[model samples]
Each structure stands twice: as C-alpha cells, then as structure tokens.
Target: MLEIKDLHAYYGKSHVLQGVNFEVGEGEIVSLLGRNGVGRSTTCKAIMGLVAPHGSVRFQGEDLGRLKSHQVARKGIGYVPEDRLIFSGLTTRENLQMGIQKMGAEALWTLDDAYRLFPRLQERADVKAEMLSGGEQQMLTMCRTLMGNPKLIMIDEPTEGLAPQIVTQVGDFLLEIAAKGISILLVEQRLSIAMRVSHRVYVMGHGQIVFEGTPADLEANEAVRKEWLEV
Candidate 1:
C-alpha cells in the first residue's frame, strides 16, 4: 500500500536518507531495521512529510511527496512516534480522545475498538497517563494511534525500554492489528521483536536500504547482519 523510490532527505546539509527505496503491501507488516542513527526514524519522518524529501512516495497510488503532514494523515496514515509522547497530566481516556481525527464516524477505529484491544485502557479510564507503567504507557500510545483509524500505521520503536512481557504484549497487539488488515511500517531496534512480528524486513545503514528479505533470510545472511546491525 506504500511505495518509496529514490527517496533522498537531509537535515540541514547532513544527508540522512540517500536514495532509500522500499514498499509495504496491504496488510503486511514490514520492519525497517538498523542500529542507532541509520536513518530509520528519518525515513518515518520523510514519509509523514515532516521533512523535505526529494523523491517519490506513493501511498495507495496517491503521490505523497507533495502532501503536507496533516494531508498525509488525513489520507489514512497514522504515526506513533518513538517516544510514546502521552500527555502526562491527562487522564488515559482524555489522552486517547486526542487521537480522534476530525473525520466522521465511518472511520475504521472507534473508542470501543480501542478499548477492546487494550482492556487496561478501559480500566484506567479516569487515571492520569503519568501514573501508568512503561508497558501501560506504550499500550496507551498504540491505542491512541488506533483511534485515528489509519489504514497504515507507522510505529517507531514500540518495544523500546519495556519489560520482556510487555514487549511480547506489544508484539501480539501488532499481530492483531495486522490481522484486521492494517498495514504496518515498523521501525524497531530489537531484532527478535521485528523478526517475530514482521513479514518482511529492510535493513538500513549509512542512510540507505542495504538488505530486504524475510526474517529467516536475514538470519541466514550473517554478512549483512554483521556489517549493518552488529555492535
């Protein structure tokens, strides 16, 4: 459902994405993997039109490169930033309400659906977001994004800084979302999480995609892993 070609982006002359190219099919979970500072986050920003990019981004055949961030969002792309930036002072219910797009009620995700996916959110409806644990915060973040009813969700580092049990929960949640036909573009530092959840993987290094394959393919190819991912 998403295609990026010859994508080039920069942060004030420091080139970040150099001719990066990839695609995510409808209902597919694709992982964009790499070590720190390899342009994984920049790729997400460029797709959302948060950065100026000299390339083509086609989402469901619409030219995305020319659209603004809000415009792109309106076209059914939701972004959950890496930081899980929940409003600390707001109640969990209130924080989720912020993700409700201006669009009408016909949108795919509803408050009921979000609560169904995350029962904890429903239980803590009146609790302040800041009082939640790290895992709860991440669940709140994901549920908040789902409230937008996006066709494709770009999740950056959803498992970062969470306990292993929470990581597993997040992975299961992603799988559930995918089963409901939501295409996911996942950026993750944890290779195991990505491998378990992603149908395909794209490895980036030095601001470009150097490898693209299935999880097993990536595992067998030690050279690429060692060069691009190994610490």
Candidate 2:
C-alpha cells in the first residue's frame, strides 16, 4: 500500500503540489484526473522522489520523504513517465531486458507477459526501440517498469497520444496489471479509460484534491467535472 498526506512540492518559489492526500491499496487501481497544471503529474513526480517533497510519503508503512528517485525505485515504486523514455539505440528486447532484475527476488512480469499484453513488442523484439511506433514505445515503457517488479506503479498518461484503439489496449493492460496484484496510480487525461479501469478517481485542481470517490460517484457529479476536469 502507498499513502501520501499533505504532500507539497516546489520548483524554487513556484509551488506545484499543495497539500495533496491520497492512498492506493494493494491490487487496487486509482486514477488521478484533472486539467493541465493541476498538479496530477507533480504528485506522481513527488511520490517517485523525482522532485523534493515536503510532507509524508510512505509506502508499506515506511517513510520515503527524503529518499532519492532511484532509492524510491529500489523500495518497489516504479514510475512510467509521459515521455515514454527508452534507449533509442537499444533493441526492443534489450530495452525490456534492462528492466528485469538480474538478481534479488522474482518479478511478477516477464518479456513473455509483456509480449502477451502487447504483441507489437514481440514483433519488434529485435528491432531498435527508435524504430517502434509511438504506441509501441509506450507499451515498451510500461513493460520496462513492470520488469522492475514494483508493488506500486505510478503511471503518468499511459494513453496520452495513442490512437483510440491503442488507448483501449492500454486500458485493458492497466486492468490486467491490477488483476495480477500490482497497485496502479494512473495520471490520465482520458477520463473514460480511467473510469473503466480504476476502482476510484481523484480530481485535482490548483494543486489539491477536489474530489475523491468511486466511478459511479464521479459520473453523478457533473459540477465537479465542469470545474476541475472538463476542458
């Protein structure tokens, strides 16, 4: 489980995340939704320790407020950024291989599992990552993190620029990941996919959580959507 309370982050004097609070239970999918500049991504960065954080960020009851990004990762928190970072020169197989732990405990996913989720990855397994399409790159990015065997994965915009069909594929993948017992914290711009895959949704505005509830509860609240989510 992961817990964040009164979480705040700053870029010099510019405050980004202000008093954000939320929790992601084991095997549950939680979506963080809001318009641009509402701090949804900042919350992910803060939780991943990519930025300096002030306030509590605990995972499995251990405090990680002061930990570095890599340290946080070592503690089982994987991050898949919106940029879909991958080694351009590396083959798809090599990129995926990079994520697998050569030692330590066993991971919950494998290249075979990733191939099953996204067959394109398997098709281009020996091809350089740079040769893959945008959707394929995103799939690779996510699978690479899964290779890390995280208890909780904070994914920022998994379906951002993909086609509608790819979006559906990614949404199904998120659901499958949860079914396999990996907690997901998805920062999504697409509310439809989020609602379909998540157990609950949290809407953020001006750097704070303005709404938190189940999908049905969110659907019934049009005012919240108008103010914090709808563009």
Candidate 3:
C-alpha cells in the first residue's frame, strides 16, 4: 500500500539515499536489509518525512512529498525509530495512551491486544518507562506505536543491542504483528532474523537497492549474500 519511486534524500551537501525505490503491499512484511551506512535507516527517516526527500512517496495512491512528519503519520504511517523513542517519564500505560488516534469503526488493534501479545507490558503497565529493561522498553515502543492503529509500520533495527533470546522474541513479535494484517517495512541488519520474518528482502548498498527477492531466493544466492550482506 506504500510506493516510493526515485526517492532521493540529502543531508546538506551529502546525498544519502539515491533514487531508492521500493513498495510495501498491504499485510506484507518487507525487510530492508543492508550493512551500516548504506542508508537503510536513512530510507526510513526519508519515508517518514524526518529527512527532506525529493521524488514520489505515495501511500494508498496519495503523494506525500510535501507532507511533514506528523502529516505523514496522520496518513496512517507509524515509525518505530532505531533508538526506541519512549517517554522515560511516562508510565507504560500512559505511553501507550499517548499514541492513540481516532479510528474508524473497524479499528483492528487495541490496548487489550498489546497486553495479550506481550504479557510483560501488562504486568508493568503502571511502571515508569525508564524502569523497564531494554527488551521491555523495546516492546513498549512497538506497542505504543500500535496504539495509533496504523495501516503500515516502519520499524528500524528492532533487535539491535538486544540479547539473542530477546531478538528471537522480537522476531516472534513481528510475526504476530504481521498475522494481524498490518503491513510492515522493517529496517533490519540481521540477515537471519530478516530472513525468518520477511516475505521478501531488499539488500541495499551505496544508498541504492542492489537486490530484491524472496528469502529463499536470497538464501540460494551466496554471491549476493557475500557481496552485500555478510559482514
């Protein structure tokens, strides 16, 4: 339901995303995979309008070229940043409440669903956000964004800096989200995790998409894996 064509982004004189193009269909999990500095994160920022972008960012056939970040979000796009931007001062429940939006009569997600998905969130519902563990904080951040009931969510490096077990949990969480019919554009560096959860994967290098295909296609292409993905 989201399409980007000839998308270019800049940081002053430095150009980071050069004609990056991709699409995320409804209820599909598409992973944007690449090593650091290839502009995977920058692509998320550009799509969210956090960075200035030139060219087309069309969501549901509407152009988002001139819309501000908040405006882009209002159009049913949720962005979960790499840093896990949670409100340290607010309680977990309060943080979830902050992301609430007016929904159509057919809203698919709710606080109840979040609690059901991650029982830890419900257990710590009243605890201050900063008091939670790193994994818990990450869960809170993703759940909080779900409170908005977005059509598509862009998650940037959701498993970064977390323990292996927690990384597995995050992968399971992503699968659960996808199961509920939400489109996802996941910016993940971990190939195994991306392959496990993504329906299709796009490998990027030098600020451009070098390869795009299904997870099985990626597995069979050792050269592409070595050249663009393997560290």
Candidate 4:
C-alpha cells in the first residue's frame, strides 16, 4: 500500500533519513524499530509530508514526495503522532470529530467502530480529553486517526509511558485493526510490543533500514538484534 525508496531527509544541514527504503503491503502490519534519534520518526514525518524529503514516496502507486501533509492525509493515510496531542479543553467526542473528512459515503471509521475498538473512550465520551489517563489518551489518539477512514495508518510509539495492561490492550487493538484490512506502519521503541503486533519488522540504525524480516526471523537472528537494537 505504501513504498519508500532511497529516502533522504534533513533537518537544517543535518541529514536524518539516509537512503532508507521499506514497504507496507495492503492489510499488513510493518513495524519500524530503532533506538532514540535513528530517524524512525523522521521517516514517518517525511511519508506524511511533514518534513522535506528528497526521495521517492509512493502510496498506492501515486508519488507523494511533493504533496503537503494534509494532502497526504487525504490520500488515505492517517497519522497518530508520538505525542498523543488531544485537545486539553475539548470533549473526547469533539476531539474525534476534528478528524472527519467529507469525501466518501462509506466511512472507514465511525463512532460505533471507535467505541468498539476502545470502550473506555465510549465511557468517557462527554469528558474533556485532558482529564483522561495516559492510556486513555493514547487510545483516543489512535481512534482520532482512525476516524479519518485511512487505508494506511502510521502510528508512532503507541505504548510509550503506559501501564503493562494498557500496553497489551493497545497491542490487541492494533492487531484487530490490521485484521480489518488497515495497513499499519508502526514506529515503536518497545521491541516486545512491535514483535507482538507486527507481522514484519524493520530494524533501523544510523538512519537506514539495516534489517527487514518477520518477527520470528528477527528473534532468531541474535547478531542483528545485538548489533542494531542492544543498548
């Protein structure tokens, strides 16, 4: 559903994503794993057109390198940023309403669908987003993106700073979403979370994809794990 080839991005003069390449097939869950500051986030930002990148970014065979961020979003791409940026003042329902786009009659996600995926959100439907706990906030962030009805959703660090039980819930939610035919591009630091949720994984180091394979393949290859992921 999405492909990036020879991707290079920069922040000012510092090169971030250098010759990065990867792909996410339809209904597939692909995790991008890396430690802090390895350009994992930058790659997502570039794909969403939030950062300037000098490389090929194709979504469903359409070139997306020059499109603006919202344009990319309109082209069936949803993004849940690392920082779950819920409106402090808006109610949970209101925050979700902000993601609705007026394009298709067959909406990909509705209130019912979101509630089914995250029942806690339904319980707090009328509450302000800021009053929710960290796990609730993360769930809300993912739901907000899903409301846009994206064919491919890119989630950044969904389990960061959450309790273990909540992390497990989020992992199950992602797996369910993938089961429903939503292609997922997951950027996560938690290896276990990535391993549990993704069908395939890509290990990034020094701004490039050094390893790409099944989660089982990653676990079996101790050398790549130690070389790219060990602290």
On lDDT, the leading prediction is 1
lDDT of 4 by residue, 97-190 (tens): 8877744667877888888888889999999999999999999889888888899999999999999999999899998899889999999989
lDDT by residue for model 2 (96-186), tens = 9999864444757988899999998999999999999999999999999999898899999989889999999999899899998999999
1-231, model 3: which lDDT tens digit per residue? 999999999999999999998999999999999899999999989888899989899999999989999999999999999999899999999999898885556667778888998899999999999999999999999999988888999999998888999999999989998898899999998888999999999999999999999999999999999999887
RMSD of each: 1.5, 1.2, 1.2, 1.3
Candidate 3, residue 199: lDDT: 93
Tell me the TM-score of model 1: 0.95
Q: Which candidate is the best by TM-score?
A: 2
Each prediction's TM-score versus the true structure: 0.95, 0.97, 0.97, 0.97
Kindly indicate the candidate among 1 and 3 with the higher lDDT: 1
User: Model 1, 178-220: lDDT tens per residue?
Assistant: 9989999999999999999999999999999999999999999
| Per-model CA lDDT versus the true structure | 0.93, 0.92, 0.92, 0.92
For model 4, state the Cα shift of residue 194 in Å. Answer: 1.1
Backbone atom clashes (below 3 Å) for every candidate: 0, 0, 0, 0
Which residue pairs clash in candidate 3? none
Residue pairs in clash, model 4: none
Q: List the residue pairs that clash in candidate 1.
A: none
